[model samples]
Target: MYRYLEQRLAVRIMEFLRQRYPETALPAVVIEQPPKVALGDFAIPLFPFAKPLRSAPLKIAESIRSEIGSIEGIAEFRVAPPGYLNVRIDRAWLALAQALARDHVPKEEATSGKILVEHTSINPNKAAHIGHLRNAVLGDTFVRLLRYAGREVDVQNYIDNTGVQVADVVVGFTHLVKKSRPEIDVLAREPRFDYYCWDLYARVSQWYAQDKQNLQARSETLHAIEAGNNETAAVAETIASAVLRRHLETMERLDIEYDFLPRESEILHLHFWDAAFTKLKSAGVLTYENDGKNKGCWVMRRAGTGKSEGQQAEQALVQESGGERVLEEEDQKVIVRSNGTVGYVGKDIAYHMWKFGLLGQDFGYRKFYRYPNQHECWISAIEGEKHHPHFGGVAEVYNVIDARQSEAQSTVIEALRELGHNEAADHYTHFSYEMVALTPRCAAELGYALSEEDKTRPYVEVSGRKGFGVKADDLIDQLIVSAKSEVDSRHPELGDEERRSIARQIAVGALRYFMLKYTKQSVIAFDFKDALSFEGETGPYAQYAVVRANGIFNKAALDADEFARNVANKIPAEEFSQFLNGEATDEIWELWLSSSKTSYVVNQCIATTEPAYLAKHAFQLAQLFNAFYHRHPILSEPNEKRKQFLLATVAVVRRELTRTLAVMGITVPPVM
Candidate 1:
């Protein structure tokens, strides 16, 4: 509401500058809302352009204020002690704009092209734990915010079907259980497929440790599966495809949806890497070395880095498995290894190249899943070469990988830059976040005995190899149970089916918000007791606040439409701004002023990849609504015009809060 007030004031200032210092070139005008509401609604600091003005900043501010004289909707104006122009907006304009914003927002700013957000691309080997929740919640929220800002967005979840984690589950089926493909398929249909594989995969990891020679079986299975020509690959595919399907169902339970499910196997078969290799070779971007530690390898040098960089990267690989990293030549990466095979990073680079349309090749897409709305859920592929919707033209690509993979992501960026597509490289953001850990008590609750080393650790690390983590299905069941108690306490008359639906809504709200409440940099300790709580500083509170607002409006006996019309037709015709004068304010005005800061909040969250910023904003809005609700009455107020204004104000709060929570994938239940 005050944005125009600032704009008008800035124009006046520039005009003053033109008249006072005619020879000076005008600079860009930047107006900012002050840190506190009482400090005036907006401020302009002139020190930044003072040198060019050839006058003191304080004098310039005063001169501009005096020369510009009075402007519309500016209640008051003054120059601060430090030479900032402070301007307060007319309180009634805020109330009017807040009411108008809902019905009269510019159409161009309300809808725009979709953004492709790929997040929570977790391996389909185990349960979706808190770490996975953080990625999905943030990604889902990002999609909502973009859509709210009028941008089109397509969500994606990338499945790494041929990765080591999936391979371990395959090993568990073949070597440990000695189960055939049909038996494995039956086992996979159980509700606990991800859970079952979680334990089995961990056991397989331990089995390999017992005897070094046992590792050969895993290597054999991996090779056979990659070769795509044997029974081992068939069995692996059955288990992988089955378990991955289960993963999708779990995500659906969390209300997460996707536009595409791109599989790594499809990328390999599509030979995206083959095209990428040809381009690199033709461009002389990759070279081969025969007289080094990695002899006979088609290689590229380690991409150039600052002197202090790549040290932790070099140390981490050495510390883990003593596996060596061989530079391709100088500032390049090996597309294929010496013994004849592609590196994991090589396939990923190819995928990135293809995403940017740099590969000059595309995947054959096929409709895989039938959505409830009958929309096609597309999957990228090679075998099922059917025509589906377009798979790639992404305006932006986000890979929700761990920070540990920064080196590989950098290689992808370097490849794009070398290909002369700087925008593609620049647009690719490695949306990295820290891992989740199990609290000591939670780890103990899971029946794991701790060594002194474990006791001294900051948090119990989630080890895929050990299956030491919370399962997504397990958490969802618990959330539903937790939510039911609250629902039953509040509305005992609700039918069982109706209550269950409401409880699930509450469950999603509680879980998504909790996952996003903490700053992304803060490591989660996967505490069950803390996660289960619905009271204080949780999603339920935010939902409860909105629910209360809606209840007030519903019980007020006047529709938002009637209330707005009544206020306009029957209220005093002096134009409320004329009476708000120099010092008076309306609470509705404060709500409008505060409510308008959402775009900045959304951008900050996007730039920082931290949902906590949004979480804080949501909390603040909830607080504002609550305080406003206590002091103001709608239907009970005998003054008809005042009553109508309150109703309209509540309506604005309700809309913005809904949009804000939706941006974070937190659905506000109508009843709580």
Candidate 2:
């Protein structure tokens, strides 16, 4: 509702300006919320128009105030000193509109094509850790935000099944553990297979450090896995498939789902790189390095550093120096090594080209995993089902990777642009975020031994290769145990299973919210106490606010929908105005205003590619409702109209809070 009013007013102001200043050019009008509610609901600065109109800002403000006729949902406009237009909305009308409105799903805008969001691409070698959790949760929440905004989104989780990580795990099982294929198969069927591999992976890392000769095994295993159809490749497939299943189960605990899981193995066996290499050569994006440190390799200029004139000048200088000049290797990124192996960036470029339908190749899809909700997840296969849903050819793509991969992501986009797919390159997004580390207190609580230096530091980075991080399953289990203990103590009357279910909900909420509360660029130091707290900017705090609001409706013996209907039927706009106006009812009015901005907040989140703003929105709305609950006596009011108005306020807040939490992948338990 707030966004609607802003757009309406902006259009009205623009139309008025065009008619008044026929010869002048105008800029886009932006609307902002006032600092205080008493000032007004929305503020529009007139300073930008002064230079274009060749007049003082105060005069422009006066002209707008006089010429801009009455707008819908707006009560009046006031011009402040110097140059500001303050808009006061009709409170009664807004309250009535909100009470009568259904859910706050924003209207879908027309889009050119489907959006592809690739997230949670954890390597299929070991158990997922807290660092992986941040990637998955951020990606999942962004998918939710895009879907909620009425965009067609395809969720993908890339599986690096044939990568060096998988090769290392295979080496661990065969060389260090000395286990045969059949022996490992039996163990893979056992519980916590991924956890077993996690420890083995760390041991392999240690073994490599003890003797440089041991590194040769990793290289041999990688080549074997890439070749396929051999015992080593089969073993690699077994371990990666098992670990990938465990990953899916862990993410499902937090309500994250994917539409497709494309594997690196298929990309290799299907010759995706062969096709991409052809295109790169035909487009002249790849150049052969005949000399220098990168001799006998296929290289390309780094993204944003491609300057033909400067390259020609450097080459001329080198020739003038009697062909003895050495080319700077740092300015070039190697796409394919001299040993005839394509680099990670080369494979990624092929995958992204497929994503935009420029590769002229498609993955064969087969049903691989099914969620409890009956959603089917497909995987890339050599021979897939004859009839399957299409997976590629998207109009836009978003890769939710860590900040460390920014350069690789940029190279892929640069390749796209060089290949003349500038539109796809322009639409590509690297939704990068910082890593997650454990706070010193959190590490100690998790029973990790810390050095004195580590203890003094603010955060401890998790190293998967060293097996020194919190596993995703273990963290979820620990959270549930802690939450269940609290639930058991607080609600002794409830059955064991009911308490357990509520605890799971709370635990998942805590985990997802903790992952999302920080901005993408901000590194998070995970701590149990901060995440599970019931007060102050935590998921539990927001969930509790919803539970408490529901309690009000329960105590009044009224269904929220029926209460809204009664308010809309019994109360008039004038009565709402009388009830919501002045200093005495400022808090109630503020709550209504906050409830109306859920769609606005969602739009802001999508535009900025940041979910932290929505997290902050939910927390702030929760804070306002909690304060209002303590200050206002809703059910016991003497005046019937005022009581109905207050109940209507509760209904609106309850609905919006629940919706907001749902979008963040958090569920409100029946009781907290």
Candidate 3:
């Protein structure tokens, strides 16, 4: 919100400089937080102009500091070591922050355009694992944060309902178990159907190992499913749809909800891919290579321009001629196989084109799942619901998947470029994070006792086929049980039902925060012991700091409103020592510094597509608040007014911390 004030000051400075120097253009100015509370609240690094300012940077800084006094909301200004301008805000100005925050009842606005975040697109045949949690949590956080920043977001969980995984599951049931829909539905009504399928899917993989001919059954099943007209296809759909519901229920437990469910089967059935293929061909991007690779299929001349073939080719050319330079060639990605069918890259390119409204077509939608006739989920196809609201027309799109898909993602970008939809391509973003692996303790707890060879690697890999990782529900169950016991211990007055609710909050918070705390690229080798901590860079600790802060506010008989009135309260520059006290107030000052840096974290996250920045800030905010909590005797302070101001500050910080965690997809426990 203060960005407006910063903008105004910058304009005035630029105008003032322009009047004085007619020949020189006004330079870029940065408005930033000062290093210390004693310093000016905002600072500008003039060293960027050490050459322009002419005199040494410090003298120039002092001159600028003197000139800067013309601005209001500024008290005294000083130059820090190595020539940084330290501008202290008038304490009275900070008091206005409370009012500004009050007047600003931030409405969570819809995103500027539709944001269809495709995440948790897990294979239908396997059980949901901890690796899936990372994708869903990060993707969901993006939806939350973007909405908070006033963006309309639509959360979508892509289901590979007709992929190889589901086909394998179909083979397992129809061929292996010889079970029909009613039998499978009965099995689904039982507990852990996903877990059962998880084992069955792995066993089915092994079943193929017994005989090479058995693979034909899988291939035929896949063809029949894709063709969408046979009993086998019907069975595959039933299994795939059921598994998807199971996955959604798992996500719902963690407070994740979605607007739509996009099935790959629908994408194929709707002829959206055919429409996309038509455009690509008309645009001369996709070629019908009837002769190339000795094929009957269509293909894309790899986007690479042949120079990327490698230096050996270039060296060979040089040896033949010795006088010219050859550039690296780029490789072509295949669109259609030589067998006259689409490849993974081809379907993905088509899906991406459709995502950005670049493809001249639309999917029909029907009422998705209706929960007790109140909650409705949407399904898309060629002739589904004809009057549903627009789904595509996204100003921005984020696909949250693993880093392994970077090359595949690039192909989508290339498709957009080839179609001349450069703006849409620019808006397309890949939110890639390293995979979540198992720490030794977590692995051992999950019944994956590692060999010495496994220990040699930095982290244990999570393999779906191996079925050797923590299931999301299993992890949540453990955390809830652990947390419920703590709740009962701390609050002996509470009933079992109330304690269960509290435990759910704590458990979900801990899991979501742990997943989000690192930058997306940082591989989380999650340790059970570390994940279970209630203090120090943990979710419960964040809640603990807030509760402690709230306790101080309550003791002073203050609430969010009353405390907000003092955000701009004046600091007595003369009584700096009394305020600092080399105690908790000092800790408060450090927390203040970190809390103020939240805007920077947010800006970086927006630019880099990294959710970990928010996670790291949440941890830092909690750590600082905890230190402040231990050092200050809040209600017992001698100066009532200063204590009131301190309590007010705590209220604001606590509100902010709780809000930050929510954006990270971690709900704060009500009584932590």
Cα displacement (Å) at residue 630, model 1: 2.2
Q: Give the lDDT of residue 54 in candidate 3.
A: 62
> In terms of lDDT, which candidate is stronger, 2 or 3?
2
RMSD of 1: 4.7
TM-score of each: 0.89, 0.95, 0.89
Tens digits of per-residue lDDT, candidate 1, 1-672, equal 444455577787677678877888878777887777777888888887788977888888888777777777676777997878888776665556555563333456554334578877878777666677777777777777666656777778888887777778888888998897788878878877777888898899999999998888888888887878688877777777677677667777777778888888887878888988888777766777766565677765565553355876775666577443442234446668877788877887788887766778887777767657676667776755555666666767777766667778887787777767788888888877777789888898988888888878879887777877777778988999889877888888888888888999889888888888877667888888888888877888788888888898678655644555455444343444543333444454567676765665776677676668888888878878888888776668887655655666677677677768888777877688
Given candidate 3, what's the lDDT at residue 140? 89
TM-score of 1: 0.89
Cα lDDT of model 2 by residue, 198-299, tens digit? 999999999999999999999999999999999999999999999999899899999999999999988888899999999999999999988778889999
What is candidate 3's CA lDDT for residue 111? 25
Quote the positional error of residue 96 for candidate 3 in Å: 2.9
Per-residue alpha-carbon lDDT of candidate 3 for residues 230-299, written as tens digits (9 for 90 to 100): 8888888778777777887888888887777777887788777888888888998876644434356665
Which residue pairs in candidate 1 collide?
Answer: 112-150, 113-152, 114-152, 114-153, 300-328, 300-332, 300-333, 301-329, 301-332
Total clashes for model 2: 0
Q: State the lDDT at 537 in candidate 2.
A: 76
- Between candidates 1 and 3, the lDDT winner: 1
Give the best candidate by TM-score. Answer: 2
